[model samples]
Target: MTRYEPAVDLNAITALDVHVHVESDDHGHFALDEELLDASAAYFKGSENRTPSVQDLARRYRDAGMAAVVFTVDATTATGHPAISSEEIAQAAAEHADVLIPFGSVDPHQGAAAVQRARHLVQEYGVRGFKFHPSLQAFSPDDPAFQPLWAALEELGVPALFHTGQNGIGAGLPGGRGIKLRYSNPLLLDDVAADFPGLTVILAHPSVPWQAEAISMATHKANVYIDLSGWRPKYFPPELVRAAGGLLRRKVLFGSDYPLIAPERWLADFDDLGIDTAHRPGILKQNAAHVLGLR
Candidate 1:
């Protein structure tokens, strides 16, 4: 029952991967059901090491000389599958605190219970932040019903990382397994950001099909940020690359969407994007450090 505390030496880590998933527990329970897991593997194509446990992830990131923020999605109501325990994940991460930062997830649909659990994850277990998948969770970020959860996080003074734009979780399944892409639109989070200025909101992934909107939010809102994850750098939208080099440089962070997209592969492709030399360090590590309060 030890509370987690980061032991990472910022100087020792070359990067902080902010979007890694701990899809399984030490007990062999998976975060997502077989159908969604298989679908995501197919969608990512290069998802070679899917379903790694927290310990496995710690070794992988540590070997790479990096730190990772690991979390699992809790979409119990939407997927009808039990989620891997965020509490357990946080406790496990405490053992690998040097290279692992744990972020908790609660089914937003759980209402008051969700808020209570979020508080416990932060005040008790010491989770650094919270992760949400709007599409997979089947809830809109700006929906007033979930405002209490956001308000709780705001009060707790931790960031909220939302999966925006396209999701690979249920990709290619019938109706994408009822996971609505519309829920993940970056614009939906603009309201949440506006409403909760105290809460830092990170829009995960490139927000494809709405890259312009994502850019607009990050540029216009001080509370909003974008994480470069889920897609290879070579395939990044031109506008996003341009913004990352200039206006959004400080507001953008690096992430690998690990297990699905390895950090090694993501970094190799990032080198080819021709991003400004000045912005590289911030994107690779500094920005993430600031966002996670590691600085």
Candidate 2:
């Protein structure tokens, strides 16, 4: 099978958004359940549209002079809701290759089949990375059972992104819809980083209550990175801001958890932070380019 490479003309784009989501597939099925969706929409107060199609996102980013890495989470085994087709997302990304890069997701609970599907997504769909939600998927990243899944992605030379810290997926609900905060602990990924030396792990968001851990992981492991997303920048933990301006400058990538958190809002708040203007380009795009092999 031919691995799909996106057809984007690098010269035309100004930024590479690393953490956008394909909440709805081409078939019009949502990636999350109704109640949880409503709660998150209300929590984030998203105004730019809660759910977007791959084509819709491609057009939006292309017109905005940006490129986006897009994907849907597959939590079928955990949530009982079937996952959107990663292959379909890949096919659509190919159509709008100039602005879209596809990422793939599989419920880790499926064990070996999950690992197999991940391989298929990379080999057949041209996914450059994978997404995992520990809390929402009811799994821990350090669990020995998931080592194979991580190993397979490691072998493929594609990065694996894990949702860390506070989650809006089950936020504000009683018991957060049974999503446990412990599952998203950044410390768990430290173990994965140490165990899988070659695997590039992205710690998504600030990791909220575990911000310190996220900082330590990025500082300790050359392969671990942090994507500044999921929260408005003005509210970013002070340590994260310090790292962005200093030691973790090149390791932090700009990512707006778009549709939930708008890029305009995130960028505006980020500008107010007084980070060195010289490093802005890397945070905004170049760093992500290094991660994506786009440069």
Candidate 3:
């Protein structure tokens, strides 16, 4: 088994996409159930193949002259569906190290086993970070029971990216398939960030319905950051665009939430946002380089 190592030269890539999803494995396993997956596809109204493997991701990003942080959400306990193997994803990413960076996901409901798997993913597979979808995973991030997981990631010295705001998963389904939206509130993560100051906590996507709370946390906490994904740039809230240009420039990252939102489409919309050119570089790549220790 190959331990992951990043071979990509930061200078060679035009931008870094920190939020691409590896929705399927080579063996035809999907990260989410068919019903939820179909609902999300409809919500995003994206026509591209939604379930791309790691190799497909590498080719797409490489062709785009970009590097992508690829991961799958493991909500096995919550969804009762087997997750795509993160280890395999990381191993595959090793083959295309120049374009793909892997992140691992563990179901928070797994308790101590989850903590152990998280360490294994980092040490054995060389994952750069961990991904959690609080809404889909059906767990509250600030729960004391999961403190060990947060502490483990802090000691591991890798970032924990939590999906904040509205989730496309389970959208349009009756009762949203019992997925509790409250768990994804960015405020829930304020506790995690505060308790684990050493942990780099990434708030993925624009935390809609609580946009101000998300911006405030990133501004208030040095370790907190925001990845702009899930929504197209043209639809970004005015305050988010404002903060991304000014106070939060260094803490914001570029992410496409690919398959749902393509990087090409995201970049095209971002170009028209009129953010200051000086801050563009940092948001597009430099800040991610620092966060990922790629520099």
Ten-residue stretch with the least lDDT total in model 1: 41-50
Report the Cα lDDT for candidate 2: 0.89
Clashing pairs in 1: none
Worst 10 residues of 3 by lDDT: 44-53
Write candidate 2's Cα lDDT for 63-169 as tens digits: 88988889888888778888888888888888888889999988899898989989988887889999999988899999999999989998999999999999988
lDDT of each: 0.93, 0.89, 0.94
Evaluated against the true structure, the overall lDDT of model 1 is 0.93
**How far is 19's C-alpha from truth in model 2 (Å)?**
0.6
Q: For model 3, which pairs clash?
A: none
Q: What would the per-residue lDDT of candidate 3 be over residues 1-295, giving only the tens digit for each residue?
A: 9999999888899999999999899898998888988999999996477899999999898998999999999988888899999999999999999999999999989999999999999998999999999999999998999999999999999999999999898898899999998999999999999999999999999999899999999999999999999999999999999999999999999999999998889999999999999888899999999899897
Per-model TM values vs. the true structure: 0.99, 0.97, 0.99
lDDT of 2 at 197: 88
The sequence of per-residue lDDT tens digits that candidate 1 reaches over residues 1-295 is 9999989899999999999999899888999889988998899885667899999998899999999999999989988899999999999999999999999999999999999999999999999999999898899888899999999999999999999988898898888888899999999999999999999999999999999999999999999999999999999999999999999999999999989999999999999888888789999999999988996
- Please tell me which model should have the higher lDDT, number 1 or number 2: 1
